[model samples]
Target: MFNGSPFPVDAFPQIIRNAIYEVEQHTQAPQALIAASALGVISLACQNRIDVCRLNNLRGPVSLFLLTLAESGERKSTVDKLLMEPLYQLEENLFEKYTHDLTVWRNDEAIFNIEKKSLMSKLKSEIRRNKDHLATNEKLKVLLASHPKSPVRFKQIFNDATPAAIKDYLCGYWRSVGIMSDEAGTIFNGYTLNELPFINKMWDGAMFPVERKSEPEKLIRDARMTLSLMVQPNIFKGYIKRKGDMAKGIGFFARCLICQPGSTQGNRQITSPVVSTEYLPIFHQRLMKIVNESIARNNENDRLCLRFTVEAEKRWIAFSNNVEYEMGILGRLSNFKDYASKMAENMARIAALLHHFNGDEGDISLLTVEAAVEISTWYVGEYVRLFSKPQEFTLAISEADELYWWINNYCIRLKASWITKNTVLQYGPNKFRNRSKANEVLNTLYSQNRILTEKKGKTVFIAIAGSIF
Candidate 1:
């Protein structure tokens, strides 16, 4: 999965392609990671304003949930910031405006309250003094109707948040939202697994009416959220280990476009131009233009529908049929029904985003749809690579590799040919301190010619293979 085929960057629009390449040159991260970040930013901005027609003929938000798997120091933060710099600036601008609006609302609300109190008192006195109470009552009614309401704070992105906090903000406070992180342990380990169903609803753009004990029950509609997380490979595996069954059972992982791109650590040689001053600024400006257009219109039900043209619709339907038929019992996609079924919709969504970003008029074209297909087909292949085999074996292989390195390092650092098994039992990795577990991993190393073990009179010793005796 880590060495999967490279993402189809050439298929992207020229505007996005240029920035991706620029980020790659500067960050030396995998292009796929950078691409995911770019798409996530687009999705977050477009989700509030645009709706695309899916195969079901129903309109769905052009939003995406992207999860990219990379190792530590893979420049996840660098890639995320490079793509989201424009959005960060937009948030700061919105916050400043909101602060001013809130202050004004406070003053108006206080005056409104004072007027209402005086009007009520006058109405009571008019009734007591046998005067015309109808005029005072009418005045009070007008004042009550004109009561000031506070401004709604507009915040679009959260680096990390819980389900409740997300609901509070995205469901009503802001129509569009995104939750992104470079190191995503806070998201994965912060009780997010328990709230998979909440995220699933957000992905489908389904209406969510939440029940509250102390507050009014809220009905949420026309809400959109995009989630993008870049986690280390180990944390990625840990998430699968803990919630694989629940996530698969409820089709949550199926809703995400998960990519495990290969690393580019040692290959980043210093180049003449260390940064991309030109391309990134251009991309940020264009991105800001798109986002500002969406927000300025205050589009709620007024959606800019991105439908497929005649030929593009045919292309999409053919792809959808092929995916359905390939999910048969004896079919190639039999083992991947959950993920394969969702890929075509994602293709349409991605195609719509590409079309709109390029400022194409009318319907989407077959050329754009084909490009989306190329990208989605690679995602199916990557999903199969990660989930085809039993995960237990994968975990074992990873542990074996770790133990082998630790053994070799221990032996070399101590200037010893072998280490006593008792020492391993006492001082090795915590999980391998036991006899049975240690042997399970040691036997794997032995079979791979990484280590040799000997027993001498009830004591066992292990040494790195090919070491001088």
Candidate 2:
């Protein structure tokens, strides 16, 4: 039923991994099941022997018990009209209204500081408006900036001020803080994983929906697995070889010229051949698990998971086809299938290695060259724009010419520096050899009338020719 094609069978791994992560993410955080269970807790608390007074934190259960008691006719039906229905509506309205108020508070803080000119004034205003609740200015800033549903930043400012004041300042902030703190106290909680930048990125990207219909646990779990796979240690060897040398034994360093019969080292005809050596049985298993779980977990947004699973399957099929075409193991279908599967086992390791190590070149030499060219082009264009005007020649010609002269002088040095500059290197582009080469090329081009020229009031002009005619 998807895109007029039957669902792919190979997507099982991704589905299973996705599902496992989803469940795992859910388990890492606390869940709220207020309706049935909370009411049960309240009913138990009603007994004098149950120490109901001591269960003051049992508001959730008590609320549910009241609803149940009303339904049983011990309380008037008007109570539902007055409280239960309104409470449900109020809960629904809270997320949007609270978030809007927080946003307003965040924006107003800057104006408040600008107008009031004192931290004390801002703090007093907040406390006066919100029932004498006390919070640091920074804490308020962070709270207002974050989503209303998000846990308060109690940990960050806990030591900056007294805990007693913070508890007093925010009206409903305490409830959320308490919930988040309770969840953090548990052994398997968000504290460990949420500290990571990647986790926060994924949470912001996947969560914060107007209505979070998709399960939060699934989001966390899948995001973690994806991130983990991305950051996992890579231990694989790969080589880039010419296409014609495809038949040769991999990892054997015989020249492409020997294999291709007409390729050379300098002017060599080349095609990229990727090879790798790493074992990833666990990764594949996890991937399959995710795919399977996605199919089974039919949430409203399950289509996204299904689509990704399908794409993975299609990629595998394409991979299989490439293997069959390369192996020259012609004829029987079974033989082709077996050969393709074996090739895929090898390819997966290479793919995993390349995923991690592909950008280790820092900035590719060619990319650096392109960037240098772009910078030079921008500078030269600005120079021409500045000098090409006749009325704007109030400054001395030599002073105006100095900018162009400096570019010519430094061109070689700039080119040399551009190529060799790297993260580990403390030196700037002016110190690199590749920048020197680029500068040399620029100078040579300038000398040959390849750079610098203009048009002047229906006349042709050139720098090397020194003519405007």
Candidate 3:
């Protein structure tokens, strides 16, 4: 199998890049996994306070749904713990305040019930005696208006939850929260994902209603959720084998940025002076600032819609058009149409995430959007690599084909019988230069008899097949 490309860490802003570097150095986790963990933290802090306005004036959530596949000993939990330390710390503090508030609410409710009952009895007595009763009626109205209101319980993260429980929390406790789990089997293997369509709706920030036999119908609106899941490969495979039809039919997986990065185990050597866990404190400190600001403005009318600069909007329009055109029946991206369709909007979300995390002033800029495009393109390729059939053109196979086309073009244009490996590495497609992936593609093309590779002295040359030229 072809290995996935390393994440484009430099494309991210300095704050996020530092966090990713620190986490990867300290834990030796896959770079892509650490990047995804960083994104989840950004989503939790920004989703409630900010939104992204698309090129066409469409406003959407500044949230992301991420899924990472890895084995048991890949340090998935470590990445999550390091990045999400702020959220957990905040949740702990909130729980203490909630415990105290619950006590006060119970006492107030008891006093309210006693006063209400007394007024109700007094009203009946006054009515029976045919008295004026105006004073009693006024007292009852005042009493009803003064009825105690229980505090809205607060929580920020959950490993596993039912839809009803989620609605209750968002409606009563917090306006925004996240479903972050390292052992995602509890969510994927259980009933949480049984309602595939509901999960998809949650990702899109759509309105949801639940009808119950025992109570009134509930409508969930203006509530936001961000999901980051890390599951074992076998567990995810089983879920897809059993329920992929339903999930894919409803476009559940398309809403996610999915990856299964090659493992880095057995290579994390213990150095004499271990790498410092630096920048985590900075990550936490910056995130808590956003959290404090978001908490003060997590209402329906308070979201800060991040508009793109003029240059950024033009770039986005061009990108959307290009991707849409590539989704034709015979187009290379035809098989992964669902992902291509939503990728542009997700790119906008990524730009907003980076912009907010870096404390950039004013609107989202062209530079940020371009960097976001680079990151999104890599993940989309990863999605295709993981989901497409073997014979189908995976990203690696696509790179190989592009390289072969380049060789043929070079022969025709330059009148050269062959090209050097160094030339291909320096002057080929940007995706064609990674030595490991490039070598694998060369070997695969050779097995297919599609190209000829010749060695002369210290140089390697590639030429088209049937070299009658």
Measured by TM-score, the strongest candidate is 3
- Give the TM-score (vs. native) of candidate 2: 0.15
- Model 1: weakest 10-residue lDDT segment is 325-334
Two-way TM-score contest, 1 vs 3, winner: 3
For residues 162-271, write the lDDT of model 3, one tens digit per residue.
87677766556467778889889989987667777766777788878877799798777767888889999899999999998887878888889998888888888867
Better of 2 and 3 by lDDT: 3
lDDT of 3: 0.82
Looking at candidate 2, what is the lDDT of residue 453? 32
TM-score of each: 0.79, 0.15, 0.83
Q: Global CA lDDT of candidate 2, please? A: 0.26
Q: Give lDDT tens digits, candidate 1, residues 1-469.
A: 3558989999998888999999998888999999988888888877776789966577887888888888888899989888898788878988999899999999999999899889888988888999999988988888888888778777888766768877877656567788878888888877554688888888888888877799988877878878888988788778788888998989988988988988888888886765667888877887788788778776446778889989999999999988886564324566778998798889889999888877778999999999899888887877877777554677899998998888888988998899877787799999999887887677667645687666557776778888754
Assess candidate 1 and give its TM-score to the true structure. Answer: 0.79
Residue 69 C-alpha lDDT in model 3: 91
C-alpha positional error of residue 353 in candidate 2 after TM-score superposition, expressed in Å: 59
Off by over 4 Å in 2: 1-89, 117-469
Model 1 whole-model lDDT (C-alpha atoms): 0.82
